[model samples]
Target: MKKEESFSLEKGEANQELDDDGKPTRTGTWLSASAHIITAVVGSGVLSLTWCLAQLGWVVGTSFLVVFAAISWFTCILLTDCYRSHVTGSRNYNYMQAVKTNLGGRKYKLCGIAQYGTLVGVSIGYTITSSISMAAIKRSNCFYKYGHDKECHTLNTPYMLIFAFIEIIMSQIPDFHKLSFISIIATIMSFAYSSIGIGLSIAKIAGGAYPRTSIGLPTRTDISNMDKMWNIFCAIGDMAFAYSFCAVLIEIQDTLKSSPPENKVMKTATTIGISATTSFYMLCGLLGYAAFGNDAPGNYLTGFGYYDPFWLVDIGNLCIVIHLLGAYQVMVQPFFAFVENWSHRKWPESGIVNKDYTVGCFRINSFRLVWRSTYVILATLVAMIFPFFNEFLALIGSMTFWPLTVYFPIEMYISQVKLRRNSFTWIWLKALSFVCLLVSLLAAVGSIRGLVVSVETFKVFRSMS
Candidate 1:
């Protein structure tokens, strides 16, 4: 078979795939690409980073944050190279398709399962986060004055319904390229929440507002060494999930104009995006720990002492809700596209395509309306059912880190970037790849253990309630 026939990424004449409302006249600029990455990467993950840092203490957690940032950046380089692997250097619709281009056949199946599962898992996480943020906002008015009022009446389901209502409108716009306008605002939303959290931490420190019960630091003096180590592993899982962006790299790259060395432009965008993420993570994680120590809340907004500047707290948290509303769709779009693609392959005659369709027998395209909404509803329902779901989501997310973030990228680089056999560079890359595989195994096990414990504890709390 010819090299051209062997690869699916080389969609020659069909390169001009239209978004729902518009045709592409030019390639996406690096800034737009950076915005998409920023929107996707810096979601609710930034809020709990203080707790992550506390779990590992400042030195270790900060180190892991930097390390994960570097690792994420490196893997991003590898994925971009894979995006340019074809002779024509065309883009793949997803990482799975890109892998199929190189490895061929059902070799990409695991990628599909793991990739889509991770995305759906992320979507569920956003559902939970948006509800929590809005719920916090709902109860904020009565927070400090707990004794003076009726019990704060807030529920996760209703807030999730509100989010679903908003998403239904956004979901109607089919392609992610169309989300560029929304993503720029979503990127600002990350900055909004992170900046507020940082400002609050500084204010507390300046005012000397440390609580006597608050832990100054998590250390051998504060806890057992076993607990310290366990928490560090948990932090690893947290940062791993936080740094995950490779799952959507290809789809983002596809929107960019197909030109020679466009992947170079992608590298530039990755630098900007990940650097912004690192800055926010460091500021929030370190300052949050400094302000509250081990007593920091899992969600930083609520962790504040509920002081007089409660209005600022509400603004930051509402930003979280707004951010997740956008980020949820960013993650979910890949799952939506994957399912849509699957349906098209299975039913080539189906009218649930990007193209306008005639109402042959049915009044409308039920698959388009029903299937998409069904998944969104399903994700929202999961969020409603499992209130204590972050740990489980982290577990599922960690499942993708090794393969999607590290192993696949390194493997593709070794396969696609030819090097002299037995050369020092070649040996070193292989060794690093092997080490990542080991680390991924350990991280996955730790994440799973955390999930199990969270489930058991949730049940215990449920029984008491």
Candidate 2:
């Protein structure tokens, strides 16, 4: 028995303390859940909101931020209930599991595709975003030394490789349950960078050196109607991306303690998390737009909107790099877990796939190391291939926003509650879902158009200006 226990521990299969559900004892609370959500939600997505506000202008942009936040919170409440099946009254460990338990069959399979696809896309997006921040750090210093007129051009590929190396190491972390510390650190880094961005914007506007402002739509004569329309749609998509954290809602909730009723605790966490996130989003997006007006760069800090106080700019960019390091793991760990768990189940008898070796105090799984490192490498390669920050952000956001954020949650809720067809509640839910679908479709079209334009102008594997 002692030898068997040691083997299990070596294989990283030991769950010494099981909860009433016979799983690892969950000590997560509303606080930790909020941290995880904030870490996931307020990432590179926040950086793009200034550009988003530029496209949509003040009224529409601010309204969209609030609307998206409300929608996310509402659907999140529904999703929280689906954490435990209505019939079985048992836990569904992940988003896919919740869908499978409540709305099984084709819908379950669909949820997997949307959820996992979003995860993979988000990993790539983080790669691109982090690399930009890394390069921005260098570029900011270059301008400070060489004068603003000097072309401080920096290639993003090298920084991307560095970021990938870090992710490759981070990917080895066993699972989501162990990422609370990283999440906490990431949460702080997010606020640090966001606060910095807000402060810089405020300074710029107060200095009275900011660009001309716009109240309604961006009526810039330099751009045509087609360009304006596309920008608006893409802006909506970026907003969608900014407010989205529903894909990981079930996973985060699963980490919470069960005593207070996980659903109740999650709802409260969702309220607090989304509320705080929205407040930050508003300040960052609006203040950034206020500072730069219609000329706001897709990435405000990295776009060199603030040239002086170079050290502070570098610090904010560094914070972004550190934050993304943890954010990448938080977003990608679920995908890693799904793939590894599936492999273990499929090849139960395969020693190479199932075995884990002890490295000092760490348990390193052979299959996990190879598979996860490869995934990070591939994601890095893709990020290098298409590093258009805003366009990629919009594409990923539009693709997953409706399905994972709005559709799956609503469908699962209706199924679990057995709501009658065309009932008042059902009609409104379906209507909201339908409206979001249209928004996503329009945003996707705009994103694809932007990508095409970017590719036409940008040289593949070449340095981004």
Q: What TM-score goes with each of the models?
A: 0.86, 0.95
lDDT of 1 by residue, 225-317 (tens): 765665556666777888777899888887665443458878989999999999998998888888877766777776653564768888988
Off by over 4 Å in 2: 1-16
Q: What C-alpha lDDT do the candidate models reach, one value each?
A: 0.73, 0.88
Write out the backbone clash pairs for model 2: none
lDDT of 2 by residue, 135-160 (tens): 88888888888888988788999989
Clash count, candidate 1: 1
